[model samples]
Target chain A: MNFFRKQSLSRWLIHLWFIIFSVFCLIPLVYVISISFSTESDLAVDGYRLIPKTFTTFAYKYLLKSPDQLITGYTVSVTVTVLGTVLSLLITAMLAYVLSRKDFRGANKLSFFIFFTLLFNGGLVPWYILIKKYLFIGDSIFALILPYVIMPWHVLLMKGFLSEIPLALIESAKIDGAKEWRIFWQIVLPIAKPAMATVGLFIAFVYWNDWWLAMLYIDNEKLIPLQYMLYRIMNNIQYLSSSIRPGTVNIDISQFPNETARMAIAVMAAGPILVVFPFFQKYFVKGLTVGAVKE
Target chain B: MSYQTKIHNSQPLANMNVKKKNTFWREFLRHKGLLALAAPGLLFVLIFNYAPMLGLVLAFKDFNFRKGIWGSDWVGLDNFKFFFTSDAAWQVTRNTIFLNFIFILLTNVVAIAFALMLFELSRRAVKLFQTTLFFPYFLSWVVVSYVTYALLNPQMGVINQLLTQFGFHEVNWYMEAKYWPVILSLAYLWKNVGYSTLIFYTGLMSIDKSLYEAASIDGASKWQQVRSISIPLLSPLITLITLLQVGKIFYSDFGMFYFLTADSGALYATTDVIDTYVFRALRVSGDTSMATAIGLYQSLVGFVLVVTVNYIVRRFNKDNAIF
Candidate 1:
């Protein structure tokens, strides 16, 4: 009984530690959500709160008043994510299938070709220049999609996954007179579905969360994705707040519900991922574990 | 038995035929279908990856819009000279490696400790904790920036509000460079520690439970069991992750450094890293040549570090090496 009590006490202490850490992880997000729902006037008066002093959806209302940018952002983000994920998965899976084939004469050379990208690169400047000047991808939607389409790491991860499929299965398909493309499309892809889902979700997350490509290549407002839209809104707010010194010309920054609206925009932007994450968490964990354990 | 014999005979006969008539062209013709399937990806890397690699010659050239990458005259190391002599070079490099080192050390320790705690929990509790902790990983840095802003925003921020409630002066968090190393480290941990902890926990779960059972039977305490069994078994993962991070010491999460700081010039004292510096030089300052040279320097050094680390890892445990 005494030993049980001691063990339980240690377990409770561990539980307590995790609860506190979990709260620490979650509070900032909750605070942001709380502040977003708070009235701007209340925010200014009460500072900020874990729960709002007075709840209002005024920030969201304000955002809806000019919905064009938000709509465009959603469209671009959705388009890039869907188009990019499917195309990326297709190329990545196809390449990985070829690489996984033991009889493919060029598999070693091709694997090295893909793997070397992990080691060295031309760095950002040359890549940016090539994309911007040489490729003429400026302000185009392809600018957003193409740069991330063939992430070498994802390729390698998919290769690792595909390599585990029994070679006999593929060989039997070949003996049945299926062409390589037909075999890959029918046999390899079906076997690799779980991996595709994992890699696909990862690629989707990359496209959905990307602002880097937009920041570099996008000058067109229509081409800006949701994350970059949030970024711009945040930037404008920061500019307003910083520019308003004690002695400045006193632009009425208060007219723009900057504080609450920024949060509202963030909640709207990240809302979908949060909703879908629970369902997808298992696959993500499986993917990460497979990658890590292979080492 | 007959099926196995037929497969064996056919495989050797196929190999013999290939060995008898194999030329590069014939092999190419034979695998054309597979090669056809590989074409799109091959073309993509050749264009997007290899082309840029060849374009690293921009590091040596004085870039002019009228004169394309190959058309430009070679400045012959002037770009590199200018970069090496700059005050920003040493500062950014030091900050990059130093901050990365600190982040890696702090995050891994916290994650390992957390993973051990999670390993001791009931399944339901572990699931609950993981779900909550992993929530932050789904958020982008831009959203995370807002979260940080909510806490650290000068006037109406949560921290400032709490400070005032505690009878203290409100901190101007953005302007203060001194606090950023700790602040950035915390932000990094908040966004990332969950993922690392998950990785470690996955590793811990894979550890044979029988070892712990045996250790307990041998009169070991829980702490002893953990120290002797859990950590020793987990060291390979710890080493692999730490070594991989060391290989990336030259890089920084540009989003975190850029967005979280809101690109405040004052905070660059502690926060400027090679990636951020290279970005600013390319976009903010329009010093393309210098940026290219610095980027090339970073790539070369980073490549060497990764190769050396991977080689060492391979020497110790060939299976665990990234290559």
Candidate 2:
């Protein structure tokens, strides 16, 4: 509480305690990275040592050598994430723009209709049956991207963000005879870039992190997203080693870097995002905090 | 309140009906473009959110897939009865609620403590700690499951290796049920606590700093300020978050339970929850109706629990109410 006065031991202790936690935080990731780069024998023998006794990309080599599944997984994940984020943002921003407008008739009810989904839902089976039977999107690429492309909560957050833009901007544009979509694209979208970026990042993350849909709808290898593919690979390791599904990969257990392969699969699945995660962290924190407060 | 009055109030003019009709048509016509723009999203929510809600009716049907949902023989409450009559009703319910109870409590304490510690730091220090802490928040649960496996793998796990070094026997973490409650919780905390901590930190920052400054002026110790000013102000946010989580207590994080254990049936005693239970049950029977029945029960119970909790919070503390 005192800026000028020093609280010697307590200050030192506080810093010490947090630094310890930071280390605790780093261990899992570091351990993961360490094992990912370790050779199979080293991983199996030394058993999750912080530093690998022998370092090799033996598993990565095998992973890359026969790369159909990995390529399929990556392509599906990237396509889904890109398309889902862009389309979702456009839809969310447009809807939020309409909802933010003070003069839109029944805006309150419409917003409530969207918001109601946040509090209640049809649950998994009904939703699954709807998509499977009616929407006819089960086991398709759209299946991976559609379910989460627009969320009601994100719409409300965008409305909150968009509402803060001065109404005169829209009013003046309307007086100039700009169409609804034009005004939304040119005037509203530019001003709401920060909010768009925030929402865009959120949407991208959801698409990237999602495996639930992949689990539910996808049975085809080509259609599988990376996360679920990694999920299959992990389980396949369990199954293959148990001889439940023989010769699925055509590699014996001891031959490939099996232990490191699972870890490596995880690393590769998350690797791209981790590379750029730091640049986006500050905005993510801000966006999530504001969203939480608003909720 | 005022809208209700306007709707019910009678007009004196004979032309009032014509005027009202004109206004309704005029307003509707004026908003046509806006409605057109909103139509797609409205449709999306209608199909995705509203249409599925209609499927809750499946709980009362026998669900013959070849015969279609409507053609399925109606079995009023039979599906629900079948679910509730089993041992699964108790087991999954207990596991779901128990895990959520532990998660809500532990995650809250850690987040708050971290938030408080974060508040005491310099701005640069805060950013550094936040970046490190939140790194894991970005990783998917599948990735996290491997990290858990790496640390808990009986023969190759870091923890087991450490135990062996110290002359303790290895822990067969996958086979063991007793340890998963803690293991799963710790895995969850490591992955999720960062984001929630940041949420609490933001709440902490919003506290009228004047309260703290004034308390310090009155020669209040740091602990006193935290106890009186910080904790009390944060209570509303705390309750809001807790109740939000409580609303979903019937639903467990499928990724957490499923992947962390690698679907090890050996550990289901401590780890299984409603989502997993339903999933496993569906796998065995391919019974869409049964799954829907369980889902409806879960959703209804959670909806009621949250509504009741929210109502009580609103009654006592109007400012903290979620709605």
TM-score of each: 0.89, 0.90
TM-score between candidate 1 and the true structure: 0.89
Model 2 ranges off by over 4 Å = A1-12, A101-105, A172-179, A242-257, A289-295, B1-34, B207-221
Ten-residue stretch with the least lDDT total in model 2 chain A: A286-295
Provide the lDDT at B47 for model 2: 82
lDDT (Cα, 0-100) at A170 in candidate 2: 84
TM-score of chain A of each: 0.89, 0.87
lDDT of 1 by residue, B1-323 (tens): 46545755779865664454545556768899988998898898888898999888999999876788899889999999998898988889989988998999999999999999989888778878888887887789999999999999776789998999999998888888999999999999888888889878877887889999999999999899999999878877787677667767888899999999999988999999999999999999898988999888988988899889889888988766767
| DockQ of every predicted complex | 0.57, 0.56
- Once model 2 is optimally superposed onto the true structure by TM-score, how far is the C-alpha of residue A177 displaced, in angstroms? 4.7
Worst 10 residues of 1 chain B by lDDT: B16-25
Clashing pairs in 2: none
lDDT of 2 by residue, A244-277 (tens): 4433553344454467767777889999887777
**Would you list the C-alpha lDDT of every candidate in the order shown?**
0.85, 0.81
Supply candidate 2's per-residue lDDT for A122: 82
